[model samples]
Target chain A: MQTIDWIVLIGALLFIVIYGTWKTRNQNKSVKNYLKADDSNWFAIGLSVMATQASAITFLSTPGQAFHDGMSFVQFYFGQPIAIVIICLVFIPIYHRLNVYTAYEYLESRFDQKTRTLTACLFLIQRGLAAGITIFAPAIILSAVLGWPLVWLNIIIGVLVIIYTVSGGTKAVSVTQKQQMAVMMGGMAVAFTILIYALPKDINFSNAMSIAGAGGKLNVLDFSFDLENRYTFWSGIIGGTFLALSYFGTDQSQVQRYLSGKSLRESQLGLIMNGFLKVPMQFFILLVGVMVFVFYQFNASPLNFSPVATQAAYESEYADEYHKLEKELELNFEEKKLLAMEYGLASENERAGLKEQIVLADQKEGDLRNQGKEILKKANDKLEIKDRVEINDKDYVFIHFVLNHLPRGIIGLILAMALSAAMSSTASELNALSTTTTIDLYKRNVQDKSEDHYVKMSKWFTLLWGVMAILFASVADLFDNLIQLVNIIGSIFYGNVLGIFLLAFFVRFVRSNAVFIAALITQVVVIYGWWVDWMPYLWLNLFGAVLVIILASILQIFLSKDSN
Target chain B: MSPETNEKNGPKIELTWQKVFTWMLVANLIYVLIFYLIMKTFN
Candidate 1:
């Protein structure tokens, strides 16, 4: 980044922070206000909810996902719209009627205090770790791009979130989220347009899409019944629905968003809006990735997208061998690019002839790239690599492209967007984590306090969690797919949490001890099942929910019969 | 029936619009399931 870019980046971020603090200055100084924001309206609540879910990972990793894997990842969201509808119809009204602060608060009323605390603890653990990962995702990317120390990047990102979130609480998060969502969506649109325009002149939007299609990047749906397959139609609808329900309905990070709505109707509307728009929004984001993939096909792309890895390779004794491989890869890319252009212009029969050539070329390129990765890995092994030795995945591709290709001012804007996404998500997670801790544990178990005291504690808790997130972010290394790691974390706990909620709501005759014990057994079983690889992670949510309800009901009968 | 009883028993309709809408929503959801399955088969 140039001096101008640095100035623009810092200026944009400073303006956002100052603007958020000023807007939420008059937020009521009470626990209710700090945690729930007294039930706001459709626009504020809806946008804040969306912003919380749309993390920096969504922007940073999704385009890279598209660039490498193509659009099939979108199939995972096919069930989200329906899941939102389910939450709206069943989850919203019940939660609103209960008048609960945290989702676990109702668990106590429905079952026992033990059940409530257990569920709340589950959320705190899962979300606390997730908060760290969310911060880590963008911090690692920015560190790689700027050559900054990961520790400093983590602290800078974590502290900025802590400042506003600790001061303005939920209201501050909601207000700034509204602005952040606007900026994120607008930035994405601008980035997509630029990507399309940057493609070769003869390859218009349609031709670019055709190139992507030919490369198998446009396979958005897979109907295979195989249990091993991750993103199939069946898994997406069944498993994805359960995951979404667990996420939006039970998780405090999401439940807290809707719990702040002014009326039951407004909250329902906000959730419905999410259900309606989320899939299409995800589709648009993935489409941007597809275009980026197309952009690279016509242009020369690096053997490895991670600059850090490339730099390390250059420094190693394998420099000559790596340069030779790079030259060979470039030659292959030029060859494939010509074949693709010919296929694009040729008639049906001639195109068929060129198609095989293109496929052969693509395979050759893939083999060369894999070989390059092997060489890089070997070099790192020999050098006594201490950290950051993993092969960089497709997630960093889009960010690298932006940093290297985009112009000065626009580069800064994109960077600011990445920071905004990271902060928006981190703020919401910290805010929710604090709300769950303070409400579910501290206020309920530790001691009762005045509203003012609770409010003060909430702020303190937010700051503490923010620091914890920074610490976690500093130590964590980049995963092959950072976004999938986030989802996998959610999958581990969501089923068990959702199961506890399901037992509470529907199993009226089940007593507290039975349900609580069943929940404990169910959680252990779910985690064990995941560890042993009995089923894919997506199915874990359904397994957890069903196991709890079944076990709780049977336990209720047994315990009651025993008392007789 | 007495006058009070008659007044209390106003409109003994079997199904109201709200009930119909609820059923409609369920039917629509069922349709979505079928549509998804079909798309899976063909696409």
Candidate 2:
């Protein structure tokens, strides 16, 4: 990175940290003010909600996902708008009625303390782990790409979040997120514009779309009934809706974002803003990825995008095999470039013949890339990398492009955008984690504590969770696939909690014991199912949610019958 | 409910928010239509 890039990146980050701490340090004299921030406007809430959800992984891996897979991922968010509308109608008013600090507090109101505490503990476990991964995910990637030390990257990101979040609590989180959101979107927009300008002279935006579409990168929606297919319209609208409901409605991280609003109307409007904007925001990011895909078609791209993996492969026994594949890929790139030019310049009738050749070349290229990936995998096994990272080349695609192609200062802005995403999400996670710890667990148990005392405790809890997340991030590399493991852990617990909330909201007949017992059983069954490979992991969310509701109702009926 | 969440934000619902949602949903549907067209056009 150049001097200008450093200035842009550091300048953006420092502004967020300092501004957040400066603004909210004095406003948090009471528990409500510190944890609730009852004066936040809709715009702040909206931006904060969006920022919390868009972790660094979303910014980094998504474009890479599009580069390899196409635009089918956008379908995953199709249910979100509908999800937002539903939350506004059902979840918002109820949360307001209870006037609770944590989402778990609502569970305590409708059910019993056991159920509430159980659910809060589940959140602490899942989100506590996720907060760590949120920092670790980006730090690892940035460290790999920039050749910076991984531990320092983790500490820097974690500490930046801890400063504001610990200083100002929930209000601090909301305050900084607005600036973070601005930096993220502004940086992305600038990157997208510059990317378009960098494409070949022959390719306008129209022709680029044609190229991308023909490459199977623009298959936006599939209305298929195939259960095996991941990103179909049905799965997104059905599965995505439920997921969003659990996330935006019940998860305190999101609920807290909107709950800080000045009024019920402000909160509802903020979530509605997210609903309207979230899908398009994802579409834009994926489009940026698709554009990167288009750029690679005209330029030379490496067989494997991960520099570490490629370097490892070169040093290992597979070095000869890797180089041979690269030679073949280079030759194929030359051939495909010529074919693309012909297809672009050809008359209508001549285009069909050129397209067939282009398709054949594209297939050969894919085959060769697969061969490269296989070699990288084989090389990984033999390498002495104690913290052996998997060689998923797709994850490195866009960052690789930015480092190689984007102008120096713009590069800094984009990195700033990514780390800003990291800090934004970590801040929210830390804030919410601390709030749940304080209000749901600590305050509920402790009687007659002063408001000032709890406020002080909230700050301490924020600092505690922040330190834990950083510690987890530091040792995260010691275990392989901790990221995927964390995601799976989240899925296991999320469904049961969502189920508990659903029963609370909808099923009046089910009381505390039924829910408490049913929740314990459902968790055991869900984890056992995952262990036994009973179904796909994604289904666990629906399965666990549905199971708890069914079991709780059945248990409730049985209890009432016995009483009679 | 606290006065913070009472009649102030009740009854007199913002017509603009309702309209805004409908408009946003309409725009979303339009986005789907445009995306489908692009797929077909370039396919």
Reference-based TM-score, model 2? 0.96
lDDT of 1 by residue, B1-43 (tens): 0011232222222333344346445644654464455334322
Model 1 steric clash pairs? A39-A260, A39-A261, A40-A260
Identify the runs in model 2 with alpha carbons over 4 angstroms from their true place: A346-349, A383-387, B1-25
Residues A189-270, model 2: lDDT tens digits: 9879988999878878877777777677899989999988899999998999999999998899999999998878888878
Per-model lDDT = 0.79, 0.88
Q: What is the RMSD, in Å, between candidate 2 and the native fold over all Cα?
A: 2.3
> How much does each candidate deviate at the interface, measured as C-alpha RMSD after superposition?
9.2, 4.5
For DockQ, the strongest prediction is 2
Show the lowest summed lDDT stretch of 10 residues, model 2 chain A: A381-390
Worst 10 residues of 1 chain A by lDDT: A384-393
Per-model TM values vs. the true structure? 0.89, 0.96
lDDT of 1 by residue, A120-162 (tens): 9989988998999888888887888788898898888898888
